[model samples]
Target: MDGFPEKILLATDGPVSMGTATRAAVDLAERGGAELHVVHVWHTVPSPHARGFIRSGLKEIGQDKLEQQVREIVETGGTVAGAHLREGQAVEAIVDQGERIGADLVIAGSRGMGRLGRLALGSVSTGLAHRSHCPVLIVPEGEKAWPPDRVLVGHGSFEDTEQAGFLGARLARTLGVEVELVGVTSESGDAQEKLHDLDRELESRADEIGKVVGTRPRVRALVGNVPETILGLYAGDEKRALLSFGSKVLGGAGRMMVGEPLDEVLNSSRGPILISPELHPASKSRVPEREQDEGPQRPAVLLATDGSEVSLRAAGYAARLADGLDAKLFALYVVDEYLTFRSGVHYGDFIKSLSENGREATGKVRALAEEAGVECEELIVLGRPDRAILTVAEEIEADPIVLGSEGTSRIEHVLIGSVSEEVLRNANRTVLVVGGHPEYARPKGESSGVG
Candidate 1:
């Protein structure tokens, strides 16, 4: 099984202010046994006659910058998968390359573009966080380290906090780091009562997070400025701790709703923060009454099952999730072609047996979804499990593909258990692997598994 970061992309703004991002990328790649790739985008001012000359000069400069970053990595015993130099807008080019490479993570400096120039081309880090499909890690100007010793999840409202806490816990587990849920209260008259209430709230959140991630995190409640209190927790040991929250805290309209405290968090010069797009703030504008009442629709959740105990567990979890989010559920079972072909003499009989098993597996998922009161559709296909899951997910516009970490205990289908890992490595969207083991995974070409 492959690790969380099978591939890492570092989006550099040039030779200046890239040291922190480069270091963080190299550290993560080495720790996760991932391939490291770098890209730099350069463009000239509007010019018709001297365009060729300007383009040539910019390309040369971009190549030099990429080489420098690569050299630093190689010198530190890190391997470089590739280096890309493109001519276009920084955010678009970097986002395009990130998608093309199927990057598991994109790391960049927070202030890659100058402060004044940010108005023209939005901050690379912010733009990537808003645009990229993969997770974006923004390393502050002087911040260092990849996976800090401690991970702090800043709690806002219950909904956003839960979303951020889930993602933060997953990342903390993958990096093997200690995690804590933090909340801040600013009441003067009843300060003690507010603090107590806040502490209880954090503990309650921690319990719910433990139910999902299997590890109950520590909780901390403070009294001070929201951004200052959160950021100050690791001021001296910035390299040893990480701050994470939902992207809604950074949105224009969301900042006002969240309070002025969040504005400081975004403007604060200290960070090596992680932001999840779980809560996207809708732009404020006049809309029809009908559309307003309906609100925005969320995508369906895809559940891949193989009739195993763990698969059943995943089905229950996925069903509950779909119910909570008011999203549809898709239950899929893939008949491994490799197993049928390997049956040789009994190919026909084996194919029949597999088809029957597929129906049973998807049927179980449907039953679970029905119990949860979630709308569901059953799909059975013959192909590689990982490939079929991804293809179906794309076709249905599934946001998260859920499956068991491993599969049934059949010798011929042993490799199929690792299909979850393969899907995670290739899928452009989020993947939830229920009941996973310590080791990550990726399947070989010859795939056959009932998972």
Candidate 2:
């Protein structure tokens, strides 16, 4: 019943950014009596005649070096650490290895390389995240060195909030840390009334959290936008925190979209985010079931990002979910293939940059997870956004997809945007979308759309 991974797969490309990931994998293996499977994927670029020979030779050399590095990391621990080197797409190879070995967790590192590197070399982390069956832990370079201190739990009006609360409290107890219960209330009322109501809700929730965790937490009731508010709180505070929340399914117009609050919180928060699916009322009874299932439940999460502030918030929330569920976190950075066609940038370069940015963003998410003492995996993709997200979720068997919400038009009161609308219409898994900046308070009757 220890809150630590028992068997993990450390998937790497032998990149310098993976150093932190390696350290984390070794640490977890040693601490949790876990077995470490070090997987290095050598993606040999296809080429013509003579160049193909040269490329193959170079790939072999790189593989050898990477194997040596894996050996070094394994030497640092007494646990079972084996190495697997395969040639294919990074994501595919990693996923195949993980499934073959029966790994419980998949660990990876994010590469912050610029747009060009991402284009030339697709983000393996992102791809593996989308395809891996086990929980994926993505550790950013510097963050892998720090230990988690505070845990942030995101709450909304969804049915999953209660379960999220339970999971957050359990994690805090496991890490021996304090939990911060944060709830975002839009300013749709008069200033005075909004403030009063916000205070009451914050206090009440804080009290409930205190009882759940056996300790009172410092409650924060901020009046502003939801994403901005959450980000601002973390920006102002220097404490290392892990954020947690739940993913809910939104079905409308024959489509399914993840809820918004969770999406926005995930994208904007700099700390790690833990996301869980909405638990049914029966599961909420807290009574022991007929039997306890020991196998890890598939922790499904939707990672929506566009390299924008709002999208980043979504990624942050997904990182927290990876920690909470001990599930694999998939980051879906859509290129808006339609938008890209209109953007006029060279498709190759643009796609590459987008992929690279996705990696950088994924790196940030991994950093947050490491700080929270959690493991993760990531993915990068190219296609129309809504379709791409849905396809990836199904392909990876993701149960919940986290997304960011923004108004399609300038109209206020539009809680969800076009992409979200499309996702809600089509997505099969639960979706959590986060909207409203947390910094600015909207006047009563004012529009809530991004103006």
- The TM-score leader among the candidates is 1
User: What does candidate 1's lDDT look like per residue over 1-451, in tens digits?
Assistant: 1235688899886654347778888877876678999998888777878888987887888888888878877887888999998888677688789889988778887654554443222245645654555567777655445447877887853225455677677667877888899888876768899899999988998999889887788998888667667667867553577777664421221111222333345445355677554323222231233246876645589998888877898999999999988998988787675564356433324544666677788888999899989988776555567887887677566778998876666542456557877898999999998874323334557456656
Which candidate has the highest lDDT of all? 1
Per-residue lDDT tens digits of candidate 2, residues 213-302?
A: 565666655566766777776678777766665543211101112233443443334455444444221121222331244443445565
CA displacement after TM-score superposition, residue 188 of candidate 2 (Å) = 2.4
What TM-score, computed on C-alpha atoms, does each candidate reach? 0.53, 0.51
Total clashing pairs in model 2: 58
What's the lDDT for candidate 2?
A: 0.58
What TM-score does candidate 1 reach?
A: 0.53
